[model samples]
Target: MTISLHRSATVLFQGDSITEVGRLVEPDSPLGNGYARKAADRVRSARPDSGITFVNRGVGGDRIADLRARWREDALELRPDVVSVLIGVNDTWRRYCSGSVTSARAFEDDYRAILTQVRDELDAQLILIEPFLVPVRDEQWAWREDLDPRIQTVRRLSQEFGAALLAADGLLNQAARAAGGAEHIAGDGVHPTPLGHTLLAEAWAALAGL
Candidate 1:
């Protein structure tokens, strides 16, 4: 079933670079040029009088631990009615590139902690987006071993927390196949292109029933 947003609700998007998309940190029009912006636009267009306010707090290079560290200020205090989170890639990426490894267990723990806080602090709905890689570069295929488990963790936690899950990995993979190749969707296998963001927005809208 599609989750419906209440009128005058505050919707918050949280995650890493994909969600950030250069969003302004200030109060006015914070959604950046990414899926969050696209999704917010669609929802507002569909119901201009819904009185839904959107906020983006996604920072580049954030891992689950980073999110846990800032949850109180960036999320809880906002008193959002709906929260959407897309994270975990950096947790796996840093291990391969920067040698800063965050194990799957730690990732799950931090993620759960954030969700627990949200559940205890507010009557907010949750949407968890799955972390994905497109394998645009041959070396990127190797990231699956690390990212796959984190993806599973998100799926399990979403169920545990009664949150909606967006199967972004599978959705983007299908989009890549249809669009001719992975590079067409995500040029570097991690960050998404405009078309990739569109796919994400459409998938999010379909999942949220906006």
Candidate 2:
């Protein structure tokens, strides 16, 4: 029988700026102000009869290495039934502006390490959110070369880890095509707009089959 969302299920969202969305900084605050909120809203709306708990732990400017640093506290400790992660953009962004260059191989290595630990130590179902870029600016246009592989790694890792995969990037790309261009969904190409958040929630809900 297919499992349905229930009070026993706890969902956690983990990522960088896009996921954080300026949520309540206090540890007391669970869902932040961005796509995390939208995602939570969609889950709640779909399963109003279910009592699943949702938490968002996205931090701005984080990369795979950063996530590796806080894997225990931010994730494993939470003991979620479902865990979702969106990252990688910063791994590329820092290379250009912050002078921190993480090669594709290194990025994948870091990501693998983090997920490996999570799989070994945690009891949650994993959900990998694909990192995306739309090239709103010239600098961002070049980010694809560095970001694509990391995104692909997430896809492969999800299958390897027996996790759910939410195609947030592809959904955004579709929205860009429908609305006009990437700028409409992601103003700066890294951060998403309100519509973009909605699209993310929709895609996530669909993937969750909720």
Candidate 3:
């Protein structure tokens, strides 16, 4: 599907820390130093007079449930023309770190619910970024048992909603191998380093056909 971030479009980025990356929360705020800012920068460079607004509402440690809980205020109320999401890692992270397991079924259910709301209530366009993993350690590889299914869920939903799908998991791993190690991109197998963020931003732009 083609997603056009047309003139005067307000694109909202939603998800966990990966999207948030320390963005400020204030009037006339600047996007944080992460992929969201970088992606916006890429588009603005090509269309200087587009008058586009990019909003980042990524809260660190947020699971799908957390995002749905505040969806009305953070997402729906903004009335964005386009919405991009990079979530699900924290859902698996919490399982390993805090014993909070979010089954893939629950993840898909909550995700579809919000997407339905976005479509039915706002008729906004969607761009779904697949959650990725690059295991720095052998143990982190175990995360695949949890993350892979969710990645598939993202793909299915993207097709179901006719949204642009950024195949980030495969893209990042390919980059990591070329860069010599996963740590070079995502130091912790989760959050991205500067280069990793660049990859995500470029991938987002390219896949969204920006």
Q: What TM-score would candidate 2 get against the native? A: 0.91
lDDT at 82, model 1: 92
User: Model 3, residue 11: what's the lDDT?
Assistant: 95
Measured against the true structure, the TM-scores of the candidates, in listed sequence, are: 0.96, 0.91, 0.96
RMSD of each: 1.4, 2.3, 1.5
Tens digits of per-residue lDDT, candidate 1, 1-210, equal 356798999999999999998875545557988999999999999889999999999999899999899999999999999999999999999999989999999999999999999999896899999999998888888899999999999999989989999999999999999999999999889999999999999988887786
CA lDDT for candidate 2: 0.81
lDDT of 2 at 71: 80
Q: Show where candidate 3 strays beyond 4 Å.
A: 24-29
Clashing pairs in 3: none
- Supply candidate 1's per-residue lDDT for 177: 97
Report, for all candidates in order, the number of backbone clashes: 0, 1, 0
Q: What's the best-to-worst order under lDDT? A: 1, 3, 2
- Per-residue lDDT tens digits for candidate 2, residues 1-210, read 112455758888898989888775755556876777787788788778688888888888898888889988988898877788899889888888878988888878888887887778875677788998867777677777888888888888888877788766777888898999888999988899889888887777777776
Which residue pairs does candidate 1 place in steric collision?
A: none
Over 4 Å off, model 2: 1-4, 24-29
